[model samples]
Target chain A: MVKALVFDAYGTLFDVHSVREKCNEWFPEQGEAISQTWREKQLNYFFLRQLMERYEPFDQVTREALRYACKANDVTLRDEAEEELMEAYLNLDLFEEVEEVLSQLNDKKLVVFSNGSPVMIDPLIDRSDISGYIDDVLSADGVKQYKPVPAAYYYAQQELGIEKEDILFMSSNPWDISGAASFGFRTAWINRNGLPKEELDIQPEVEYENLKGLLEWRD
Target chain B: MVKALVFDAYGTLFDVHSVREKCNEWFPEQGEAISQTWREKQLNYFFLRQLMERYEPFDQVTREALRYACKANDVTLRDEAEEELMEAYLNLDLFEEVEEVLSQLNDKKLVVFSNGSPVMIDPLIDRSDISGYIDDVLSADGVKQYKPVPAAYYYAQQELGIEKEDILFMSSNPWDISGAASFGFRTAWINRNGLPKEELDIQPEVEYENLKGLLEWRD
Candidate 1:
């Protein structure tokens, strides 16, 4: 239905929990909490930065949020664990079904639209050796904003030099999907949490449990 | 010092932990997680709605976030306990030191700047019997956008009919303080979490461990 299928990166492509699981081994005492706080602050930083009209790479925000989380949880880590967490994030294993689905979706243009910084997402793709399969990776870097901002969708559209209606956006986060949907993109929601749609004014055009469901959905 | 002394209701005045403690008694199984999720979604709704140019009452978002959290966590509630959470939120007990400090600050123009609805915060003051002491109860009702938006602060400023610099905004949440600071209001950060100051571009003019710290400095 759309020329390009744009997927969200963190929860959709990468195994976020598994990355935390790996981090837990090295920072045994506070790894799990670190992971959760890191994720929370990651989202928080994205929103706050967008509001402030300042943008930094996701890696920098990741480090900042990770440090703040450590302080909040009373976990003391020298620079080592921060580096470890960064490394763990950069080397995340793609979801079990990600590559297969991406291959199938590759019949059309496949792009990643993420709140991640270029430094963070690019290295992951390179390390995973999926660079050949992806046509583009668009980060929120330029706009200093994250998804759910209509401007975020506009950034991706402008960067790719494509019309908004021709881009099929998908995200695991309901708020992001709602933003994309409202911004005039055809959206497929990856409802990993199985939560019902929010009572927002806008709604996603398609809903699937995950990427596999998306792959099974014929246009 | 600035003229108006604005207080944030949830964590600064009301003991949010006590609110959760009350929740733990009711749901017992999934209460804590549900409470946490409720808080997250409540804020998410506020920020998302603000971004979308749609304004709903904070109480509505609170209820929706609670419903979604309960459903997400598989916590089924009977009638009263479900109602009790909202009741508990409205009738929240002020922290042990709240009344004395607020009484001391009553010499200045005082306002309750909250993301809550008028109905929500009005009852809170009425239930606490501190209604007469407060100069004004400013909810995000009229503006339809919640705090952290320039528009929300502008609404508060417009309501007070005071210069932005004349308002001394205070919040237990750093982001609120950051937002207020960005909104051109002088701010005092109530760092109850004892967390480090984030690297946000905005900074508070004053920092206190709690409201009591402000009382000592007040002339």
Candidate 2:
């Protein structure tokens, strides 16, 4: 019996890529390049920081990665437009299935396990106002290390007060799914982009292209 | 006070991107996509594996990353051709200025600290015939973790019997530079592509566009 659903917030619960629209609105053709590279660099920086023991908040990582992304793509951040994009990022729209599936599964505890800082995550939840469904927000700063580090998962487990097997852990990142699975959670990989499994030899218990797959299964 | 000049093997001394020529040769007009994606996936796998603690040999990582890159880029890896590429990989030619600079800096104890497996690193050194300059080979398998991990650098420091700052660490990767610098080694980033520094806030002591810059520095 799954007692609760633990979600990886950035890509699994909220669509990190949804910033592409605001990006495109601001910069004509460079939005996709900026958005894609920014997201990739953001995660890459997370791993680098964790390994190097130079921990920074996720919001700072986001801005710094964006700076690198724009520079790498030969785009300029002018007139404080980058700030606009960052602000818009905080209100990132939920994935099409997020609200519905989350509501339908209200009987189970809904928890967010995020790398986002409280300042960054709390507003997004407030703006989206689906905050009611969530029982807890476990941001990585709680442990001073990001996810995939065993310490981060252990912290989440202690807070959730549920046995690892009794929780359904969900993430859209293959690496996160692998990490969570390796940590003994029943993992769901929300592979929204239809990417291949990470070649880490560990496999998630199930995968969905979107969040609704979880709802459909639970229904 | 720099007693040894430690190098990163894959991209700093060897031309990893040279695989693009063979990739283009094997699959008509698909070389750049295959090579770039292959290299990116290779490093991505390193971080993922290290974090997941499901470490594999670097050679195995090269093969697996290539498999993913080929699939991601819609290119098929023919059986004999992948074998052919792996064989070619073993004999990757030195970067244009690698041998010349190593010869110029022969007074220093030149060393290689790589993520390559011995099977991969030893043969590459032998085939390239630059074994005379390198006094030591420290592969990551010694600790079963990839670079930017403190343990990997720690092993190298112990093996060299030299203090961290006394080792002039060199790599073409910004993350490696950042990691080494954080580990208290003076670092030289071979920024061959003139790429921006990683957002980690740890800048290298010096940077070069290629290996020749190191020689030019000592001169």
Top model by lDDT, which number? 2
Error of 1 at B199 (Å): 4.0
lDDT of 2 by residue, B65-105 (tens): 88888888877788988998788788887888788888888
Per model, how much of the real contact set is kept?
Answer: 0.31, 0.58
Residue B44 lDDT in candidate 1: 82
Q: What DockQ class does candidate 2 belong to?
A: medium
The TM-scores, one per candidate, come to 0.89, 0.94
Once fitted onto the true fold, the runs of candidate 1 whose alpha carbons sit more than 4 angstroms away are A21-26, A80-84, A161-163, A193-201, B16-30, B76-88
Task: Specify the highest-TM-score model's number.
Answer: 2
Any residue pairs clashing in model 1, and if so which? Answer: none
Q: Tens digits of per-residue lDDT for model 1 on B80-184?
A: 776888888887778777788888777789899888888888889878856767888888777777778787789999999989888888899877888889889
List residue ranges in candidate 2 displaced over 4 A: B75-79
**Cα lDDT computed for each candidate against the true fold:** 0.80, 0.86
